[model samples]
Target chain A: MLSKKVILYFILITGGIITLAPFVWMLSASFMYDGHANVYPPRFIPDIFTLTQYEVLFQRLDIGKNFINSLFLSITVTAVSLFFNSMAGFAFAKYRFKGKNKLFNLLLSSMIIPAQVTMLPLFLMLKSVGLINTYMAVIIPGMANIFGIFLIRQYVLSIPDSLIESAKIDGASDFRIYRSIILPLAMPILVTLAIFTFMGTWNDFLWPLIALTDNSMYTMPVALANLMGEHSKDPELMMAGSVVTIIPVIIVFLALQKYYIKGIMMGSVKG
Target chain B: MRIRYSAPYLFLTPALTAIFVFFFIPVIAAFVISFTDFDIYAINNFGTARFIGFDNYKALINDQLFWTSLKNTFYFVIAAGPLSIAISLGAAILLSSKLVRLKPLFRLTYFLPVVTTLVAVAIVWRFIYHPRFGILNYFLEFFGINPIDWLGDPNWAMPAIILMAVWKNFGYNMIIFIAGLQNIPEDLYEAATIDGANGWQKFKKITLPMLAPTTLFISIITMIGFFQLFAEPYVMTQGGPLNSTLSIVQYMYQEGFRWWNMGYSAAIAFVLFLIIFTGTLIQFKLQKSPEA
Candidate 1:
């Protein structure tokens, strides 16, 4: 029995190390000076730990601009999406209307249509309206997603209708009921959705790669990729850039992981 | 009464309108544009583009690169999908075991890659797969295996990407599987143990059957997501080493954005949609009939 327990720990620990090694390597290599990461029998730690790689990334590469771009876009998308999805979700949950079921079902089924199908025409449409190469190009499509609305609606459904009815009887307006009752009750799911949205926008590569044509407007991922194109020889610098790109989302995930994990479980409950 | 009647629509108006204009319309427009010879010229003036039905699809059929990308995408989905799901299930089972301690810490460590920026990690793995200085090759040398040019060899490029993808994604499905495992009533396991069933028998008789629905859901979503492989190969090899790792979405991006062959790109997009839709339907059908 003792041997079995030892074997289990051994397996778990081994798996954990394999899973974390790349990240550990990345963090270690980021602090090495130029050409230092390329030596044979790769050094796991810097010979003389330095901040030169990070200094180059921020000062020479001006990745700070891209960092701001990513942060701005992620926060903007998350806040706007939360508002729009919650409003739509509240309507779907509490209200009676013509074709509500039909419309909701249509929206649900449309989720299967991959976003790639719309990218070409969406680009064209945005280009025609002269919205290309702007923040709006990213924010517009992300303003409200079907999944966000569905998640919000599922959580909002559990809020007792009696509260809304009581609020209504007290001559509170419809908007008032939504603002006071639904919003407060749905806070947990909202936080969950917020984390998902924030991470998604921060980590997004494709759309930003397409829409943000200028280098200055590039998000962290796109900037990192662009830097990679020109600086593949500089592993230390690239690793530093990578570290900068990933740290915020990791911190966000670790800080709010309970909500994030709950969100995933809630989303998988077959809606 | 008037205000009450209008309230839902008022609340829904912003979201519904955004979806209608940005999402629904673009989807329809993409379908329409796929039937036309839309290109850079079409971007300048819509009237210059000519309607050419099925030509794009025919072109795709004849296009060697498109076929290569389709094959590569299927290869990725078929290979990586099952491998990731299996690892996820194994990890889920281990974590859920009563003997485990520090379950949350272990889970967070494993799930770290899932939440990181994909482009950044792909770059990190690109270096990690380095032939001479890479930690992977350095570790493998202890087992008497020679260093491998992981991203430089046609035979190994796809496998490298698959390994990285599996590492990055398994934690997601692991979380879902843990939820599924927890949902199984404790009494089911209690009854099996009381019957003098061994561990393997209990798992086969109780766990597998109970986890069917969750497995089905995981498999379908994982397949869909895997079929859309782009960033790893894009950042790692640019679909190189003889294009062994080019994905369908990458191909679409090349034609649509890089080359501005919008019509052909839209056609490829539709094919992807059809494949995913068919895959989902087939899974649903398969899952339904087995129980009956």
Candidate 2:
């Protein structure tokens, strides 16, 4: 019985360590000096730690500029998308309209058509509008995703129609009722959706890679990927860049994890 | 109850407009462009585009790179998809056990990989899979096994990426599985115990049947997600080692972005959509038939 218990514990702990080792090693190697990380037997911990790689990243490679670009893009995307998605979501959930069910189902069915299908022509369309290499190229496409609208609509459905009706009876305007009543009531889910949007935009890779051709406008993931091409030999430097790319997401995840997890459950059950 | 029609339309305008311009417009545009011989020349002047109806799709049927990518993507989905589901089921079963303690800790540990940024983790795994100096090779030496070139070798590259992907993703399905497990009544297990059934019998007779719906859901979602295999290959291998790890999306990116063969790339994207659409429909049909 003791042996069985020990075996179970062993399996669980080993699995945990395997899941975590890459992240641990990434953090460790980020502090290692040049050529210090490429030892024959990989070092789990840096024997002589240094901040030079981070210095090189921020000062020489100018990752700070890219970092700011990523932050600005994520914040802008999150803020704008949340507003757009919530407005549409609330309308879909609460208001009566023609072809509502048809439109909603159409959008839902289209979810299976992966976003990659749109890339080629989307790029050309953005180029035609002279939006390529600008923040708008990234922001415009992500402004109101179907999934975001779906999530927000699900949350808004639980909201009582009486509240909106009462506000209407009180002579409140549509925008006024949305702002004063619906927005306040839906704050929790809005916060949850905000985290989702922010993390998604911050960590987005492929779209940003295709859209943002200019290095000056590159997000952190795109920049890190490009950096990997030139600095493949410099593991320490690459680790530092990875750290920069991942830290914001980790921080945001830690802060509002409940919402993130809840969002996953919501998506799973509904989807 | 007397809501104005225009109010709802006004509320939906921003999202609908954004979706139309960015999503629907591009989709229709991609279909249109796929019929043309659009290439780098078309980028400079739209007049350079010639109507070459179905030629791009025809070309794809013979393109070696397209076949390689489709094969690679299939290799990834088939190998990784079931392995991921199996691991998640195993972990979920173990954690769902009455014998287990510290459940939340175990759950959180398993789930850490799922929530972490994939691009960042891919970079970390790239180093971990390094042939000469990676920890993976060092660990293999202890078991008297020779260090195999994980990413560097053509034969091993796709498998290596698959392994890393399974590890990164299994946690997500585990969470879903745990929820499914919790939804199963304790009464069924109790009845199995009363019949003198051992653990394996109890799990086989009771748990498996109860979890069928959840299993189906997991499979479809996992299947959908795996079809979008892009970042792992992009970061770790750059679809390297004889292009063995090159996925469909990566191939599309190469055609569209790298070579600027927009028409050809658009055709590849449409093919992916067709595949995913068919797969999704099949899964739903199977799900419906089971109930019927």
Candidate 3:
């Protein structure tokens, strides 16, 4: 029994280190002076913790612009998507309409079609509209997603009809009921969907890479990829750039992980 | 004027309209474009696009890069997908065990990688796989192994990407597996014990059968996700060291976006979609067959 316990702890500790080492090394090396990282024994701790790497990233690389771009894109997409999707979801849940189920099923079935298939023509369409390299390019396609609507609809369905019926009996308008009753009741799912959308948009790379031609308009991931092309040799500075790009996501995940995990479970159980 | 029938449509009009205009239209356009020869010349002027039927498909057949990318993608999915599932399941079982303490801490630690940005982690891993100054080679020296060029060597580049992918993804499925494990009734274990079943026998006969549905779900989702391998090699190795790590998606991206070979790229996307769809269908059939 003792041997088994020892073996379990051994395994857990070793696996934990393996999972976390890259992040630890990244944070540690990011503060190391330039070229101070490329030595034998691979410094896990810097001799001197300097902010020069970040200074270079902000001052020279201008990653701050990309940072703001990522922030703006993530927040805007999340807010806009949540409002639109929740409205559609509320309609699906509470109201009866002709061809509603059929339309919803069609959207659900099409989820299997990978996003890449639509990306090519979408790029062309956006190009024709003169929206390339604009925030609208990223925000427009993201404004409505099938998964977000599905998630909100599932949550909205669980709310008892009596509550809405009471609100209706009070002579509240349909729009007023949705705005006051539904929005507050659906807060948890909205938070989950918002986190999911933000994380998805924040971590997104390929589409943003294709759509945003101008460097100034690039999001963090796109900017980081560009940095890799031009600055592959600068390990410390690259680590700093990575840290800048990843910190917000890590903050968001750590803060609201319960909702995020709940979202995943909800998505899998139904989907 | 109370609860008018048009309310639902009014509520849904904005979202439905956006999805229809943006998503549905683009998908059909891609299929149509795939049947034509749309390239840089066509992009310059829409009228220049030619209706060249089946030529892109024929060209893909002859294209060495497409074949290489497909082979590499298969190599990654086949190698990485099962390994990830096994690791995730193993971790889930251990964490679910009553003997384990600080389960939440362990679970959170394992799951941290799942939420981090893939590009950032890939960059961090690139440094970790450094030939001369890497922690991996440093640790390997204790066993008298020489430094290995992980990202630089074609032989090791894909393996390096696979290792990083497994690290990044296993935590996700681990959470799902934990949920599945919790759903299993504890009485079954007691019943198995009363029958004098040993640990391995209980696992084989009881746990395996009960977890089949969850396993099937995990396998399908993981396979579908793994088939879209792009950013790892794109960031870490650039599918380099003789294009050993080049993926189907990456090839499509390069052809469609980089070179503006929209028609050919669309064909690649459709092929990937078909592969994923067929894979999902096979999983569903396999899962149902055991019951029947």
> Tens digit of lDDT per residue, candidate 2, span B1-292?
5657689999999999999988998899899999998999899799999999899999999999899999999899999999999999999988887777898888888887776678878888888888887888888899998989999999999999998999989988998888889899998888888889998898777788788888888888898889889999999999998898999999999999999999999999999988888877787787768452
Whose TM-score is greatest here? 1
> Which pairs of residues have clashing backbones in candidate 1?
none
Docking class of 2: medium
Better of 1 and 3 by TM-score: 1
For residues A62-161, write the lDDT of model 1, one tens digit per residue: 9999999999999999999999999999999889999999999999999989899999988988898999899999999999999999999998989998
- Over the stretch A1-271, how does candidate 2's per-residue lDDT look in tens digits? 7787787888888999988888888999999999988998888899998999999999998999999999999999999999999999989998878999999999998888889989888888889889999999999998998998999899889988888888898899999988998889889888888998998899888999999998989989898888888988888888888888888888887788777777777777784
List interface RMSDs for the candidates, in order: 0.7, 1.4, 0.9
> Which scores higher on DockQ, 2 or 3?
3
For each of the candidates, what fraction of the native contacts does it recover? Answer: 0.85, 0.74, 0.72
Query: For residue B290, what is the lDDT in candidate 2?
Result: 48
lDDT: worst 10-residue window of model 3 chain B: B283-292
TM-score of chain B of each: 0.97, 0.94, 0.96
Off by over 4 Å in 1: B1-3
**DockQ of every model listed?**
0.89, 0.74, 0.81
Instruction: Kindly list the per-residue Cα lDDT of model 3 for residues A80-176, writing each as its tens digit.
Output: 9998999999999999889988999998999888999999999999998899999999999999999999999999999999998988888988899
Clashes of each: 0, 0, 0
**Models sorted by TM-score, best on top:** 1, 3, 2
